[model samples]
Target: MLEAIDIHADALKRAALTAGPAARVPNCPKWTVHDLVAHIALVHCFAIGLAMNRPAKPAPPPDWEDLLGWWDGQRLALREALGQDPGSPAYSPYPGFDVTVGDWTRRMAHETAIHRLDAESALEEAPETRFSPEFANDGIDEFLTYLAPRLGRKTDIRVTTPERTWSLGEALAEVDGPADDVYRALWGRPHRASVTGDLAPVEAP
Candidate 1:
C-alpha cells in the first residue's frame, strides 16, 4: 500500500507540473486536471478518516498549489492507520466484505494508482502502467470476489498474464493481457480489447 501510494503521489505531482490545472483528463472527461486533483485529495481524506474510525466529515478541497501537500498529509495519516491490527474494525462502504483497516489500505492504494494514471493521461504522456505482480494479482482476486458478483453472471472466466493465470466462475469467458492492462480493463477502463472473454461489461463501483 505504501509503495502504491508513493507511485500515485509522484505521478500526480508530475502531472500537475506538466499539464497544469486546465488540462482535461481523457479517462475522467468531466474533470480537468485541477478537478481531478481535488477529487483525489478528498478521497484520500475520506479513506484515511474511515480507516481511523473517525467521522466522515468532508474536508474542504485544496487549491492547486496546495493539493500535493494536502494529499501528502492524508497519505501519512492513512499509513499510520493501516499499521494497526489488520482485523481492527473499520467502516467500509462495502460492508459485505467485513473490511478492516488493512483492506482499506489495499483499496485506497489501487484507487490512488488508477487515478494517477488518469492524471498522467491528461498530460498525453502516460507512463507504462505497472503494479507489482503480487499487487496486480491480489487486485484481480478482490475484483472477482467483491465486484464480479454484482454482474449477476455465473459464466466461466479466465484471466491470464505473463506472470500468472486465474480461472474464475463456471463459464468460458477469457481475458488475457499484461497484468496492469488487465487490471485496468477489469476496473472498467476502456482497455477491454486487451482481453478476450465472454464477460459482460461491468461499471466500476
Candidate 2:
C-alpha cells in the first residue's frame, strides 16, 4: 500500500503540475487542480494525526503556489507514520471500524488513486496509468466492505471484473468489465464497464 501511495502520488503530482493549478478538474467539477491538491494534502494530514495518535486540528494548506511543497512534506510525514506497526492502535475517522495503521493505509491508497485519476483527467492524459489486478481487487473489496453500504444502496447488484466478482445485496443486476474500470465505476468515475441494470445502487453518493 505504501508503494501504491507513492506511485499514485507521483502521477497525481505530475498531472497537477502539467495541468497547472488553475486548471479545472472535470471529474471534480467544483475543484481546480489546486483544490484537488489541497484536499489530498489535508487528507494526508488527517491520516498522519490519527496514525501518530495526536489527532491535532488540521492546518490550512498554503497558498496555491506552495501547495505542492506542503503536500510533499505531509506525504513524507504520513509515509513515516504509516511505516510503523500496522496493527498499532490509532484513532479512526469512522467509528466502529478498526483503528489501526493498516486500515488507514488502505484508505489513503484508494484516496490517492482516485484523485490521481482526476488529476490525469484534468490534463487530458491517456489512461496509461492503471492499477494492477491484485491491487484493484483489493480496492474493490475495501469499497464494498467499508464504503458501499454508507451510500444507502437498496438494489442488489453483482459486479464482475477480470480479477474478481463482488455481490452487493442480492445480485439483482450486474456490472462487468476490467478490474480498473469496475473499481473506477464503483467510485462514480468515468469508466468503460457495462451495466445491465439500474446503477443507482452502486453509484457513489
Candidate 3:
C-alpha cells in the first residue's frame, strides 16, 4: 500500500507541476489543477490524522501558487503515519467496524492513484495508466468488500478481469474488462467496459 501510494503520489505531483494550477482537469470538470491538488492534499492530511488517532484542525486551502509545496509536506506526513502499526485503532467513517491504520493505508493508495489519473488527464498528453495486477485486483476487492456493502446493494455481481474473477453477493450481473479499467469503473470513472445482466450503476462514495 505504501509503495502504491508513493508511486501514485509522485506521479500526481509531477502531473500537477507540469499542468500548472490553472489547467482544467478533464475528469473532474468543475475543478482546476489547483482544486484537484488541494483536494488530494487535504484528503492525505485527513487520512494522516485518522491513522495517528489525532484530531487535526481544519486547514485552509493552500495558495494556488504554492499548492505543490504544501501538498509535498502533507504527503510526507501521510506516508509517515501509514508506516505505523496497521492494527492500531484508528478513526474510520464506516460504522460497526474497527478500521485500522492499514485500512486507511490501502484506501489512500487507491484514492491517490485515481486522483493521479485525474491530474494526468489535465496534461496535454495524458500518461499511460498502469496499475500492477495485484494492486488493481486488491482495489477491486476493497471496493467490493468495504464500499459496496455500505451502499445497501444486496444484489449479486460478478466481475471478471484478465487476471482473476470474483463475485459480490450472488451474481445477478457480471462486469468484464481489464483489471485496471474494471477498478476504475467500480470507482465511478468512465470506462468502455461491458456490463451484462441486472445491475445498478456503481455509485461513487
Candidate 4:
C-alpha cells in the first residue's frame, strides 16, 4: 500500500513539474498549478504537523511560488512518514476524523488523483490518467461529500450521459454516467455526463 502511495505521489510530482508553477490552473480559476501544488503540499505538512502536535492555523500564502520546492520536499517526507506508518492516528479537518494510516493513505491517494485532473484541465487536455475503481469511486464520493462543501456549491451536480456530454445550465436535465464523470462534472470540467438539476458553477466547479 505504501508502494501504491509512492506511485501516486511520484505521479503527482511529475504532473506538477511538467505543468510548472505559473501555468493558470483552470479548476481554481484564480490559482495557478503552482497554487494547486502548494495547497496540497502545505496540507500534507499541516496534517502531519497537527497529528504531531504542531497545530495548524490558516494564514495567507506569501506567494504560491514559495511552495514549489516545499511541495517537492514535503511529498517525499509524507511518503516516508506514511510508508513507515500509514495507519497511525492523525488529526484531519473533520471534527470526527481521527484518521487511521490506511485512511490517510487512501485520502492522500484520492487527493492526488483528482487534483492531477485539475492539472490536466489546466493544460487543456482531457485527463487520460486514472486510478482503480475503488479509489476513483471513493474519490467520487469524497468529492461530493467533502470537497464539494469546500467549494461552497449549493446543490448536487448530477451527470446524465456517459458518452457524449449533454448540456447543463439550460434546464433541469437528467444526466447519468460513471461516478468519475459525475465527480468531474461537479469539479467544473467539460465532462462526459448528462446533467439535470440546477447546475451552477461553484468556486472550483
lDDT of 1 by residue, 57-145 (tens): 65645676677678678768777877788779887565454668777777777778778878888877677767776877777766766
**Which scores higher on lDDT, 2 or 3?**
2
Q: Comparing candidate 1 with candidate 2, which one achieves the higher lDDT?
A: 2
Where model 4 places Cα greater than 4 Å from the true spot, the runs are 1-5, 51-54, 57-66, 84-87, 96-98, 124-127, 144-175, 199-205
lDDT of every model, 2 decimals:
0.73, 0.84, 0.82, 0.59
Error of 2 at 59 (Å): 2.8
What is the Cα-based TM-score of model 1? Answer: 0.82
- Superposed model 3: Cα runs more than 4 Å off: 150-155, 170-172, 197-201
Against the hidden reference, what TM-scores do the models get? 0.82, 0.91, 0.90, 0.67
Could you tell me which residue pairs clash in candidate 3? 156-170
The Cα RMSD of model 2 versus the native structure comes to 2.0
The TM-score-based order of candidates, best leading, equals 2, 3, 1, 4
The order by descending lDDT is 2, 3, 1, 4
- lDDT computed for candidate 2: 0.84
Model 2 over residues 62-174: C-alpha lDDT tens digits?
68767777888999999999999989988865656657888889989998999999999888664677788888888888787776654445537888887688776877668
Candidate 3 to native Cα RMSD, angstroms: 2.1
Stretches > 4 Å off in candidate 1: 147-156, 170-172, 190-193, 197-200, 203-205
